[model samples]
Target: MIIAVVDGMGGGIGSQIVSSLRDELPSYVEIYALGTNSIATSAMMKSHANKGATGENAICVSSKKANVIIGPMSIVIPNSMMGEVTCRMSEAISDSEALKILLPLIPEDFELVGLENKPLILLIKDAVKLMKKEFNIK
Candidate 1:
């Protein structure tokens, strides 16, 4: 299945998301890194995404053609500071018609969850894993 791992601003949380996914998903699964910048994509690339790209097309791209889209719940939040996740980007994903696994952890001030990386990753890890199980992706 094709899964787009979307992120922005160098994918600080995005990379953490990829780390968790790396632990859970086997290699056969298709993983795409959709970042707002090249750095974000590179971070996920280190996590072993099959492909990576940066820009508006990351959002405008088709989702109906993919199996699922995974990222922070904030990705849907328009004009958020954590990333340059513009309204148009959010709209593109919303229109994709693909199943999404979004983490509800809003990081106190709508920013990255500071130095508390472990807990943040754990929260995302558990949530995504449960969602994947519910969807029977295993």
Candidate 2:
């Protein structure tokens, strides 16, 4: 399956997600790193994504091809990621048929109530676990 990991603003989150997926999922699963910028894409590539792409066009195109889209909830929020995420990019991701596994992280202006505010590592682990469960992997 093709799993798209989207991120921006340093790609730290995307990199971690790629690394964890690489370690947990079977090698056959394709992990595509979709970044909002070159720096973010580079970071995820360093973490060993099967492929990487940058910018709105790349994201818009890749999202449609993915079986699952995983990223911070900000990915679907227009003008999030310090404005790196455009309205068109957000729309494309949101409109994609892929199942979305969004981390609750968001910009300061917004709030996701009732979440435990777990650390990033735990959040990523939970995401991977959910992916496995949803797809019935292993």
Candidate 3:
């Protein structure tokens, strides 16, 4: 299956996701790094994604192709990531057929309720577990 890891800004979150997925998921699964900028894409690529793409158009097209989409919740919010995420980029990801696994790692303004404050590593492990469960990966 193809999993898209999308991110913006410095791409630290996306890179972590890619690295963990590489270590946990089967070698057959494909990981696509989709970033709002080249810097973000490069960061994820360094984590060993099968492929990488950048900018709004790449994100829109890649989100459509992936079987799963993983990233910060900000990917679905227009004008997010300090204005790097555009309206079209958000819309494409939100509208994609892929199963979305979004991390609640946003600013105070977008804080989610009913979620315990967990470290990023813990949250990423949880996300990886969900992926394994959904994909029936051992």
Candidate 3's displacement at residue 75, Å, is 0.4
Clashes of each: 0, 0, 0
TM-score each candidate.
Answer: 0.80, 0.98, 0.98
Model 3 CA deviation exceeding 4 Å by range: none
Report the lDDT tens digits of candidate 2 across residue range 1-138. 999999999999999999999999999999999999999999999999999999999999999999999999999999999999999999999999999999999999998888998999999999999999999997
State the TM-score for model 3. Answer: 0.98
lDDT values for all models: 0.75, 0.97, 0.94
In angstroms, the error of model 1 at 110 is 6.6
lDDT of 3 by residue, 73-112 (tens): 9999999899999999999999999999999888557868
Per lDDT, the best of the predicted structures is: 2
Residue by residue across 40-111, what tens digits does model 1's lDDT show? 889989988888888777656745555778887767777764557888888888878788777665545666
lDDT computed for candidate 2 = 0.97
Better of 1 and 2 by TM-score: 2
lDDT score of residue 17 within candidate 2: 98
Pairs that collide, model 2 = none
Q: Which ten residues in a row have the lowest lDDT in candidate 3?
A: 104-113
